[model samples]
Target: MGVLTGKTALVTGASRGIGRGVAERLGRDGPRIAVHYGSDKTAAKETVAAIEAAGGSAFAIGVRLGMPGDADRLWEEFDRHADGLDILVHNAGIGTSRPFAEIGEEEFDRLFAVNVKAPFFLTRLGAERLRDGGRVVNISSGLARAAAMPQLIAYAMTKAALDVFTRDLSKELGPRGITVNSVAPGIVDTDVNAAWLRASEEAWQEAAALAALGRVGTPADIADVVAFLVSEDGRWVTGHWLDATGGSLT
Candidate 1:
């Protein structure tokens, strides 16, 4: 049996990209994964199928975030499947590519609503159902600490807020032996960045050059980091922002 054979993990936005990677990785450890998707039911099912094909257990849960009662709605759906949670991976987030000056109020609010508020409230509610010694891993971005792209100012701000939440929540959940941390990645080659990143050879090369490793990061890279964090090996580590950035921040 794997290390997490009997555990239950909820990975938000598991339909695609980094979130899907995390879900699949954790599922491989034998946990019963709740594959959360915003609106893509088909993609969510595919994620579940992939996990099952790997000899893992998983089910899809769909709920649109950034709304008034998103967290509550999500938990309600989750309640139908499991009674408790052992791991909570808050990976669902939206990004804004608009420059600071061009971003409108609605756009900024929407970003915060989906990226920050959703996770904030979701964690608050999930904590009650989370077992002692459970894990809470928040997917953060390197932009939170560095001004990597001025155009993504609003997106960076949301991640910054998430990091703060990670730090503070760690203290709150420490007594229960629940570890909370933020894993910040840099320039990961996921579907989210595929459009601009794959536009030209020069574009891809420039992105790769930003990382000290001389190549762009992959979803698997981030997933491996998260797998370590949620495992028994990471029990003593908490309240930290892990840089899974391929040395980009260096």
Candidate 2:
């Protein structure tokens, strides 16, 4: 039997990248999965199908992560698909690399809405249905503590805010037996990083150099850490970031 057998998990932005990888890994333990997507309907369906083919229970739902009323619609679909919630993964986020001086108010709002506000409210919604001893893993970035890179101020700010949420909420949820934590990934090779990956050999090599592992990260790398964090072995871990960063922050 899977470690998570009979559990229900909701993974936002699960249509692709690290989220997709985590969803697939968790499905190995026989948990029902709600794969939430923003614009990639086909990709989301494909991910769900893959899970089902692997003998796991899974389905896809759509919502614009940063839009008004999106959270309500997402929660409603989640209710229909899941019997109850045990694990909640806030994996949906957007990244921008514009100059700080050029960042308009609208851009800032949009970035925070998706990267911060959506996850905050989702955590609230999940906490209501989350069983005692449930798990919440907020996907953050290594950038939270890393030396600043170009065009990532607002994005990093949003993730940095999540660290606080994880730390503070761990204390609040301790009595309930629920564990809250964040996973900060470094230079993960996802479509979101495709532009950088394909930018030039030098750029890719530089990313690799930053990692002690000497390579940019794959979705599976981050997923493996997440799987551990939400598993029985992770019982003693909470209110901390497992730092899936390949030691880049070091």
Candidate 3:
């Protein structure tokens, strides 16, 4: 049996990119995964199929975030499937690379609403259903600590806020043996960045050069780090922001 054979995990935004990778990885460990998707039901089903093909269990849950009743709606859907949660992976987020001066109020509010507010309320309500010794892993970005991309200022701010939430939540949930952490990744080659990173050879090379490892990162690279965090081996680690940045921040 896998380490998480009887556990349940909820991974938001599992329809694609890093979230998809996390969902699949955790599924491999035997957790009954709740694959949450914002609007892509087909992609979510594919994620669930992939897990099942690997001898894992998973089900899809769809709910649009950044709205008033997002968290509540998600939990209501979740209630139909499982009673308790062992892992909560907040991987759903939106990004913007517009220069600080050009960004409008509507854009900034939407960024915070989806990226920060959604996760905050999701955890607040989900925490009651999260069992003791459960895991809460927030998929943060290296920009939270590094000012490498000035154009992504607003996106960076949201991640920084998430990191703070991880730290404070860890302390608050420590007594229950729950662990909260933020995993920061740098220049991951996901659909989110494909437009720019894969647009030209020079762009790709420049992005690769940022990582000390001599290549851009992949979803699986971040997923492996997350897998370790939620496993029994990571029991003693909490309230920390892990740099899964391939030495970019170093």
Candidate 4:
């Protein structure tokens, strides 16, 4: 049996990218995975299929976050599949590529709504369903700690807020043995970054050089870190911000 054979994990935005990676990894570890998606039901189905094909079980749930009553809708759907949660990976988020001066109010508000607010209320409302000794991980960005991408100023702010949430929530959930942490990645080569990162050799190499490891990160790299964090080996770790950036911030 796998380490997490009886556990249930909810990975938000698991339809693609890092979220999908985490879902698949956790599912392999033997958890029943709830693959949550925003609107891409087709993609979500594929994610579930991939997990099942890999000898893991998973189901897909659709709920657009960052809206009023969104958290309520999400949990309601989750209730249809599982009784409780052992892992919560908050990976759903939106970003703005415009510079700070060009970022409009709506864009800023939307960033906070999806990236910061959604997870905040989701955890608060899902507390009852979150089992004692559960794990919570927020997928953060290296931009939250560095000014490497000033164009994503608003987006960086949202991640910074999420890190703060992780720190404080760890304390609040400590009594129940729940661990909360922020996993910050840098220049991961996911679909989201494929267009730009693959545009040219120079673009790719420049991104790779940012990390001391001299290679661009992949979804699997981030996923492995998350797997460690949610496992029994990570029991004593809580309220920490781990740089899964391959030494990019060094």
Candidate 5:
């Protein structure tokens, strides 16, 4: 039997990239999944098809984060799709390459709305409805800690805020037999990042040099960690910032 058998999971931002990877991997464990996307209907449907083909359960749902009553709409989708939730992965986020000085109010507001605000509200709503001993996994980035790129200041800021939320939410949720934690990844190779990875080998090598593993990370790399955290085996872990960064911080 799989680790998360008979459970339900809701993964936001499952249209592509790391979020899609996580949802696909977790479906192997036999949990009914509600895959949420902003607007990529086709991508979301493809995810659903893949899951069903593999004999796993999944459904596509959509919501525009930062909209009024977004929480209500999100919960409605979950309720209509699944009876209850056992795991919630807050993986929806956006980041730009704009420098801090060049960052505009709209950009900051947009990122925060998705990266920070939506997660917070979703967690609040999810916690109340989640079964006892539920798990909440928030996808953070190593950039929150080592956000050295000048062009990534705003993105890093949102992640840093997410870290704080992860910690505080864990404390509040712990007493309810629920666990909350964050997973930070460094440079995972995925379609969304193909442009960057397609660059010069020298540039790639420089980036890889920072990783103790001497290579770049893959979507599966981060997904595996998230799957473990959402499983029964991860019960004792909570309020942690687990690094799936190939020991980049080590």
Candidate 6:
């Protein structure tokens, strides 16, 4: 039996990219995964299928984030699938690279709504449903700690806010044995970054050079770190911003 054989997990934006990787990893650990998708039912189903194919249990839930009542809808759907949650992975987020000067109110609000507000409210609504010793991981970005990409300033801000939430919420939930943390990844090779990262060998190398490891990160790389954090091995680590950037910050 896996370490999480009888546990239940909810992964947001699990239809693709890093979210999918985390979901698959947790599912492999034996959790009944709730794969949450935002408008991509087919992709969500595929994620669920992949988990089940690996001899794990999973189900897909469709709920578009960034709108009013999103948290309510998400929890309502989750209630139909499982009795309680052992893990919560907030991986659903929207980002933009628009320069600071050009950022409009609508764009900024939308980013905050999806990236910061959603997870905050979702956790609040689901607190009672989360069991003791539960885990909460917020997928943050290295950009939140470094000004490497000025154009992505707004996006980075959202991540910084998430990290703060992780720290503060950890304390609030610590009494119940729940641990909260933020995992920051640098330049992961996801579909979202494929267009540019694969544009040329030079572009790829430049991105790789940012990390001391001299290689671009993959979804699985971040996934493994997340797997460790939500496992029994990570029981003592909480309320921290873990740099899963492959030494990029160094």
Better of 2 and 4 by TM-score: 4
- TM-score of every prediction relative to native: 0.99, 0.97, 0.99, 0.99, 0.96, 0.99
lDDT for residue 17 in candidate 5, whole number 0-100: 89
Look at candidate 3 and tell me the lDDT of residue 157: 95
Compare candidates 1 and 2 on lDDT and give the better one. 1
Model 6, runs deviating above 4 Å: none
The lowest-lDDT stretch of 10 consecutive residues in candidate 3 is 144-153
Clashing pairs in model 4, backbone N/Cα/C closer than 3 A:
none
The segments of candidate 4 whose C-alpha lies over 4 angstroms from its true place after superposition are: none
- Give one digit per residue, the lDDT tens place, for model 6 in 1-250: 9999999999999999999999999999999999999998999999999999999999999999999999999999999989999999999999997999999999999999999999999999999999999999999999898756779989999999999999999999999999999999999999999999999999999999989999999999999999999999999999999999998999
What global local distance difference test value does model 3 have? 0.96
Cα lDDT tens digits, model 3, 1-250, are 9999999999999999999999999999999999999999999999999999999999999999999999999999999999999999999999997988899999999999999999999999998999999999999999999866779999999999999999999999999999999999999999989999999999999999988998999999999999999999999999999999999988
TM accuracy, model 1: 0.99
Per-residue lDDT of model 2, residues 33-86, tens digit only: 999999999999988998999989998989888888777888888888775788
* C-alpha lDDT of candidate 5 relative to the true structure: 0.89
After superposing candidate 1, which stretches have Cα over 4 Å from the reference? none
Give the Å shift of residue 67 in candidate 2.
1.7
lDDT for position 86 in model 4: 95
Per-model RMSD to reference: 0.7, 1.1, 0.7, 0.7, 1.2, 0.7
Model 5: colliding residue pairs: none
Clashing pairs in 2: none
Residues 1-250, candidate 1, lDDT per residue (tens digit)? 9899999999999999999999999999999999999999999999999999999999999999999999999999999999999999999999988998899999999999999999999999888999999999999999999866789999999999999999999999999999999999999998999998999999999999989999999989999999999999999999999999999999
Q: Per the 3 Å backbone cut-off, how many clashing residue pairs does candidate 5 have?
A: 0
Give candidate 4's error at residue 129 in angstroms: 0.5
The model with the greater lDDT, 2 or 6, is 6
